[model samples]
Target chain A: MTQISLAKCKVDQLVKLCEEFGNQEGELINVLHKAQELVGYLPREVQEVIARQLNIPVSKVYGVVTFYSFFTMTPKGEHPISVCMGTACYVRGAEKVLDEFKRVLKINVGETTPDGKFSLTSLRCVGACGLAPVVLIGEKVYGRVTPGEVEKILKEFN
Target chain B: MENNITLKIDNREISVPKGTTILEAARELGIDIPTLCYMNLKDLCIKNAPASCRICVVEVEGRKNLAPSCATRCENNMVVRTNTMRVLNARRVVLELMLSDHPSDCLVCAKSGNCELQDTAIKLGIREIPFAGEKSEFKVDLSPSIRRDASKCIYCRRCEMMCNDVQTVGALGAVNRGFSSVVMPAFDEALIDSECTFCGQCVAVCPVGALTELSHTNRLINDLANPSKTVIVQTAPAVRAALGEEFGLPAGTSVTGKMVAALRQLGFAKVFDTDFAADLTIMEEGTELLGRLNAFLNGDKEVKLPIITSCCPGWVNFFEKQFPDLLDRPSSARSPQQMFGAIAKTYWAEKMGIKREDLIVVSVMPCLAKKFESERDEFKTNGDPDVNYSISTRELAALIKETNINFMQLPDEDFDAPLGESTGAAVIFGASGGVMEAALRTAYEIQTGKTLENVDFEGVRGIENLKEATIDVDGFELKVAVAHSLGTARKLMNELRAGTCKYHAIEVMACPGGCIGGGGQPFHHGDSARIKARAKALYTEDAEKSFRKSHENPYIVSLYEEFLGKPMSERAHHLLHTCYFNRGKEIIEQ
Candidate 1:
């Protein structure tokens, strides 16, 4: 993953987000959430800014960011793709569907395409068990996702 | 009486404090409980009782499961069984499961004989790990002062606590989760690249082979074997108090004479004392303090007050990284280890007719940061370090044993002349408040020009993390503060940064109880009494000396007269004084 420099980020906005939470260490998760929303991901430079504002160590901020699955250190593409790897989805061949997405997009899990169009990731239990194999792109959930439909899913993003 | 609670352990009745943990109460009763992830240094206010390691679990009456004695608080009528059959089985299973994933390369490990895990395994009589599983492996991380082997880590988090909570360094933390979890620096940055100050407190607390000092004994051995080099060794003040522990002697036994004899046996050309350089440090540092004080009194607004001692390399790295804006506030005097190296390679080498390149200066210090300090670019000449390398007291002890020299059987011998003689003021530099007191002894007499009948400044002594004292020198009140451990140093530095500091001088040491509790000293195993004992030994040595002030050392006076004109002179400044850098700029402002 390429390192996103702080020069490219809206540094002022990051400080404003920390000030929004009164710069308290207790509000770290909330600050990280807002930071990810502002910069699309929590990079090293962004976490450093938040840590400085919160009067804590950057290592601690990074530790918290890595602990929870919601926070991402690398930037997601314009359209982020997540394949559900829940037990129900796995029983219905979600692995094959994920593999199809990997082959079609030329990118592996936790990575983005070079064209900045799509990124792929996997999650456990998206709570759409009735749909068995499930896949989510942004806010749109495609139930009963098949390995063959992986191409169709990419076509819509394109 | 109301605060006291009665409790029973293995049918023995005992009364304890209301909030006392089962571990402490059981210890009072002479119950030996095996623990892995529990550490408590009460004197320094450092405690790491994560209870993640279930080896300390014990049976409790009317409880559903075994309770972790290290964290479980005692209550009235509570009955605990520390060595019950069920508890033993549970502990054995926990140990087996932990050993299942842990690497079993104990023989070649750096911490093999001294490892607490090995001792516990022996005590438990564990023949083999019944559980078999895939072990987690990781590449070893090496730094100038410390080595981290995550594969040997038991997810104890003792290092994590010492780094983040106690030292406030925040270099190591618990990352990832479960079987894949390991304590590491942020973003997996190397320790040298991270916020680590190379204090080595983490290594001091580690129970296994996970964290250990980066050994330089092998290099020292090779250097000694080379007949072309005139190898000289300098022993720091703290080494005398603690080196005895490596042998059969008690923690606080002063083995200065025997240590010099052992160094001679190790084939070192000259066995000098860093205490001599410590006396010279006072000459340089004391003059700098007086100059700063005089300037500050004359209303020279640019001069920084409360000149902090720069002898501790760990504390120097700390301020440079954490409080970079106040970098100029610290004294520019080089540490005794570096001063000895610089002077040995120059004045001493020239006097002995040995070339600088051929004269190798090695220091035995009670600090890991000394190793890092010896390698700093500014301390080097044309790419050759002033001090070739530094070995810890533990490393020196290992080298003695490795050389087949029986330390206990060695005769007590005096150090070599010229660079071996030192005053009592220099010997106390091992303890936390020793520097401040030593400076006061000289600074008071110099500032007042009166005969000081009472040389002892008893106020700035002891094992407290922070201590403050005010001395009236010629009716001019001189305020001073002494702080040990980076945690307390942070508190003092934060005060200085905020402009609320009222001290004229402050001495800060990175390790608890100063160099006596240094990271490279023999492990105290969370025993605060051992630290106090070391400090007492230093004070006792000081009381018995003829010259109690740094300015009174005859050799120091002659060296200044023959070579350097005076303290703070151009020659003295060039050889003894050094500067600080702003290491926080890249991370904080980039």
Candidate 2:
């Protein structure tokens, strides 16, 4: 049996989240979506809690988290930046735009800055191929973004 | 039969049953289809044809492109071209892509000669990889029994299927996406950190160098070479039936004599058989079973029903982690390997007048878990392991070859005396239901004090995951269930938990076909027939024995009369009996 975590409050929340889904293994994705929303990220500890609650192995939960593009293990910064690497965006110089964001932010893709104010990540298709080379910062989207505009985009977050 | 589908492969017509895949149909037609990630242990309910590798793509006539024969169901009047130029080109291109990211260290790979990937490459005649790109790099994860190198994995998912589906351990699964995707435990932790039972089924089915045993050959060799040490080796019952396969002997061929000769040639002072201890185990375990049966008959509520066998180290580890609450339900008798080691360290050493420190006892087992079992703290005495260490049947073969011992030509020799003498009952312990059958031969006679007319309990035999039989022994219908894989064992355990199991006893073997199909045995390449063959070999050896009962073994009778005093005696408990640990809480510590 899975012992309750020492951090009782958050673990209670995780247990509650799993109970909400009736602890069905088929609801792993839905539970994961809500759990990620609640916890901000799916760390190994959180995954173990969910695994115990759902009566599944931690490896299965981790496999699912690692398989999907949206699910992430690390916490996102307040000003999380995502550059689309979709085929359409790539055709429209998204690589250059992504590199410019990395350069200005001084953080690699999937990494956060030392100050933790900004995190960089790459996305497949934001479903905004019409707005090629799109970059998003916290809900705000920048379309037709040029490498030259990367500095201005960071200024808005600042 | 009426719904049989007709398909033509290479213009040869063939009719197959419905739901038969194109790959099976093609193979039936004497066409060998090159495949990756398409393993099918038909009778065992283990399959990995995820169609991810796509190496078995065939040109299905009228289709726009090629179709994966492994996943595609053969249709009526379907025309398939397996060796078409287009199919060949597609297959080679897929191979090149896999090889591009794969490490080119075939020479040093543990699976170099026997790797399915290498064989497939050679079969396809792939010369050079045209497409080179970044490879997935993962830190090597080494457990006591298995080593995992994600970089060498070709995404075949065979190990994943074996670990998750076949064994139901769920210690491994595919993680990440696209090229970064690789199979591993959560957080890619070392295998020991996960709930891995060290069953090594993953290692057994791994087609490449991604999964291999953690070889301890060098340590064993050094111990053998030490002049000051008196080295003795005990071979497991299952080893003789399968060790010949590594030297090109057909599967299931009994090489006991030759194996003994080879061991002797390799400088071991004495070569013993674990079967002797297996016979001793039967004497002890059989008595324990009868005690429980009598207690239940007397309305003792505390006596747990359906006492499970504890001879398999893998099964022992599984229950310790997954079913800790039922730890007392299993027999406390140590496995034959450990029992042999304990007796060798205590009784044999005492008789020989050799200090225990100078005596080195090694086990040659057909299991990887036995390697882990020997080093366990519970199996140790005053910081010294009862069994100093153990090597797999594969490792023993390697040692024999390295020592220049001709295994095939060597004359068959009998096992040494005192600790090596065993009966037919012990010999059959190599098979899945063999232990139960062996125990019946003794338990029945001991309880009734009558001669057992026929020792063969054929009802307990077969390779099915779970089997049940009832024996009417003097009005006591002893219901026994034999379960050989953890997946199947889980079902029986669930029955016990639900209060639905009425069995008086159950035998559990973690590997598919008991020890004969153990993870450390010569690789069967997912062919279960070889496992059946090995089991048959053990049966043949059993039939050849004069004494067919454990209680009748002269050596066991003497051991009890002299040292043990009787079954379940204090001295017997000190050496032959062991306890189970609750590993259920261990996995969560991390």
Candidate 3:
């Protein structure tokens, strides 16, 4: 069983955020998005609070959260790295670059480093196939990446 | 704004929409312009224009190099010779180049007869490859529900476009460049390790055997050879409607009994029906819907509006990834596949006096998503998966052929008594709006305290993506909504959020036509055949049935009386119902 604890200060902050976005109705998704941003993930305590504040069921909130790809409930690392492996990128060896990142990071895609410095993730084609082999470090896009460029990319992130 | 273009294709002058591609105009004029990468209007046109394959070249008047029709837009007055000598030679050259690197071993490949490449070669009358090059050597990926053979890929980008743009789960893309270009997941990660739901949409669109469903019948054969495991097979409601296509039986032919007999001939210990669990799902879900409605009436704090059906694993996964906050609203009742596993492990194990672990539950479904659903952590029953294995309808047909079973001569046999027995309400579980209709059949009866003379809720049954109905039951009018595809589901959800539509209940299935038209079902040119077949079989099964409603299912009544106490009872809620958590910002770490 996963033990859940409610942090009063954080809960109050989340409640204030929810109130800022119009208490109920369509505010469920808005509140959830802000909660995820604040807590890194939509933890159970935050969901329960949102459910109570919105006067909606926890199941409904969970269903919406689970149905969308954008939502995540777990804590993330300080720096997140997402590599695009779309058709154009794939044709140009984006996969090999990703493999080098996995090897260098000593962590698989979707896994964060033990020190919490970086999290590596792979995305389907980001519609940037023309560039071939593109990697996104946060909002910045690096096109035509080689396997050898992975170490330099990681150093920049750190 | 009114720029109509008249094009002469094969000597017929036809008017087409302004800016229509030459291929589209040609299609309207009933002229065939063969293309590998051009799939209708969906994919990117001809891999960066001027045609990479050059197969669709047509002799447009005054155009040099025989303009590729797919890339060139229609002009005001175009004289196109679709079947000229120059066009034929150009198509032949293109076919020859495509076949150069392709494996000549088409006879053994899964897509041998169905491959578009082979069909194009045959059409172009090319028996030999003129330009040979170093063929890419790649091993087969026998991952979860799909197989990948990169060596056979033509770099058509059909699968890539569909996966990234259509489904939006970009699991596969081109890796490396130039001669070494290969389509694969990032870092060569196993597909099972990614977010792929194994919907098989990519497989359906693939022009060659580069993508296929992973086959597990060999392991089944090995298990059959071993004297230890007691293997029992169950066919989903959708499989019976589509499996007949493999045989010369017309699509939608009710081959339920023949399907069972075929499995029995293949030496299975027992042949069961997933429709039985589909009935069981109705019993559980129908009662849950009533309970939720009652809770709302009573002003319960937990107001989970529009309880979504969680039967389609693909839809469930889609929701889990995209709408994690709404997970709690999904019906806690496991899908017919998962329910079959739970019942087979618990009740069937007790009835057979065999250890639950010893019974191998093999499911034949019309879906590739079931392959992934079977591996979900939530599906585990007492430490082991309730269902041991799941095989798609196509793979099962392949297995029957591999085992040298005489499917034509097999006599129809009945499914095993207790667990095999299902109601008409269950049979419709294969088609769209089936779950809602099944639930309504039982819920109306339960709520009204009177038998529903007409079990068929005609208003809710159809192939449309979204449907709505207002039923007057015992002076209470219930508004219901049904949506099958994600696009439609999104529409309904948006409407609900905007307060534009208010309904007591809403049913949404991820696929277009429910399980019958699932991503894992047989690849049909169009859904008309399979949809008609499934709909006809479901209604026919309903008309011929003694019990047409879930409430009338004696097994369900007895199960509730013996153990569950009642529908939505405390124990039943604990065992049959489960809570969902919001995975808001957590990436599903594979």
Candidate 4:
């Protein structure tokens, strides 16, 4: 089932965006990037619309979306939290920092808070290996984050 | 002068044309190299050499690592060892890793004996799996015609290539990432919910037990055991051509008489032929084509040209899902399987003084889609299906084996009278361009007031993807086309969609070589030669028939006179014709 009723205006905007890309199948990933930006996140309805506009199978659209971890089918929270799991961060105890965030947020990785205020995700190499075990909330970054500093980091977002 | 590449394989020198893979070069030298995730149906222009499965790894003299023989091109003077210790160890390790992630249920697996993975395991002399880990598990998707067991999938991607690239159905794709990756429908939906045409090409190409036909042999056995019900069976023309392969008989060997005898021994009350209904199909479809052509000639702008054949259920589902707008362009005549079911359940049932519910009609087809076709709601009345069950040629062969009947030793026996009788045109329905040729043989004679001495329409009789020809029907130039496989069909459909198609009639078969290369036929393992052989067998049978045209079948003529007034009559339309649905709308609405 469609996870959300994508607004009619948003649907029109998606179609317009696809038309701008010439609706070529080769531009699928590019179209999907713009679609995700417009729709906040790629839901079933959004993917279906993009597939119809591009004249390809919805399964193919879903395949491309699922292949990359950067693309998400579910909506991200307003204050998104990303835990860097690069080699430097993992060696510096990023798993403990991630576990602390999961405990305090009461949500697993790639999940949003019940109030939809914060979403937790683990990404690879944000190019800040010097600040190992880094945790970023929205635009603010906390370098060399420890397990105890997770709640304080959440308080700043609040 | 052709540029050739010289290669040394197992100390044997051989020269092959440029761009030939090491696998092909080795094969040329009669060196059998094991491979998986590599398929080449050259005749259909379909090849899936992803090199995902490293089972075909070989030792190259200069390379640091073992190269996949299936993907590596033969280099001039390049030394290759197919059976070195290093190569054997790497191959075994690769297979062990695959087995660690795959379920060990081969004993009860549908493709137990026929699985390529299992064969490779034995060929490599693998006794124990040295590696064990968590096996990926996914819910089995059981569609009407095929079964999908994702747990058994080894990520070969052969099914993906067949579904998307070859058939252009787009029902399956490689989804997710890493260990959880699988070839499945979008959103992990069941195949029935997706745009799957039930072509079963995915099942045909799968090297493991991940994909297989949803068999009806068990239910058929139950029906045969039920004494209260009189079970009658009809075998499709293509089944006779390829069924012998299941019993170790060579490809292209027609075992029609032996097959009939086996079915009789299997305790069926009557063993009929689907070719009878194929003849009936030509009578209705040929007449419909003539009517539309004549109407178009008389300045009727509404008449749709290029009337596509509706015999292949896989092709029917393809148009319904992909080309819904051109629904009116296809002929309305039901497939031969459905036509036979309708006749058997109505005319024959009543004549035998048997109630419809008491009479069971089973079809032995060389197709997987016919199983899905038989289950369609349109082919049913008051919850009772016209055909009680549909089984494949492989299933019949299995039944003959399960019953301990020596298929090779069986005596030659003819089909039962009346319903069993058919014409040459009907038998040719097994091949790709056959329906178009059969219809032309009858339509040419019926349109002009001249006898068709030359029944063979050579232009439409081949394995070409898209074939076109023009015939002189009196003074009129009648244009026609034939296409096999959905990818080829899509090209023609796109032409019609663009309003550029000029043919008056077109025929499309979903499989590569029509029913002879059907997904439910004996597994060719991506060999185009086997498919060619099966097609040759069908043509041989067609040549041997006494009556070459559908109209020449006396039983069909008598049936029209006694039961159904004539072709396209009200009664005939109700039973012999059907309508199309916009499955695209259904999917979108859902």
lDDT of 1 by residue, A100-128 (tens): 99998899998889988899999999998
- The C-alpha stretches of model 2 lying farther than 4 A from their native spots are A1-6, A83-94, A100-106, A123-158, B585-590
| Each prediction's whole-model lDDT (CA) | 0.90, 0.89, 0.75, 0.91
Question: B1-590, model 2: which lDDT tens digit per residue?
Answer: 66589989999999999999999999998899988788777666678889999899999989998999999999999999999899999999999899998999999998998898899999999988998778788899887788889899998888888878778888899898898989998888888878899998988889999998889899988988899999999999999999999999888899999999998888889999999999999999999999999999999999888888999999998998888888989999999999998999988899999999999998898899988898899889889999988889988888888888878899989889988899999999989999999999999999998999988999999888888999989998899999998999988888888889989999999999899988888888878789989999999999999999999999998898778899999999999999998877422332
Ranking the candidates on DockQ from highest down gives 2, 4, 1, 3
TM-score for all models, in order of appearance = 0.96, 0.95, 0.73, 0.96
- The Cα RMSD in angstroms, rounded to one decimal, for candidate 2 relative to the true structure is 2.7
lDDT for each residue of candidate 4 in B1-590, tens digit (9 for 90 to 100): 36588889999999889999999999988999998899999887789888989899899998998999999999999999999889888999999999888899889999999999999999989899988778799989998999999999989999899888889999899999998989999999899988899988888889999999999999999999999999999999999999899988888999999999999999999999999999999999999999999999999999989898999999999999888898999999999999999999999988999999899999998889999999999999998999887998888889999999999999999999799999989999999889999999999989996899888888998888888999999889999989998998999999999999989999999998888889899899888888989889988889999999999999999999999999999999999999998877321322
Give the number of the best model, judged by lDDT. 4
Per-residue lDDT of model 1, residues B474-502, tens digit only: 87789999998898889988888788989
Docking class of 1: acceptable
Give me the displacement of residue B410 in model 3, in angstroms: 3.3
Interface root mean square deviation of every model, in Å? 5.7, 4.7, 13.9, 5.1
lDDT tens digits by residue: candidate 3, B1-590: 56478878787888877888888788776777788766642211112232556778888887776888888888877888888888898788778866887899998898888788888888877867879788888877776678888889988776665565545555666655566666676445566654455767678667789988777777788877767888888899888887877777777787887789889877789888888888878878887788888788789977776677878877776666546656766788878888787777776788789897788888998888788777767767676877777988887887787778777777788998667888888888888888899999999988889988887788888877678999988887888988875656757666765667688777877655677766556676433455556677777877898988877878777776776687667766654555554433231111
Off by over 4 Å in 3: A1-158, B1-7, B12-33, B40-54, B65-78, B101-108, B134-142, B164-166, B170-189, B493-501, B526-533, B569-590
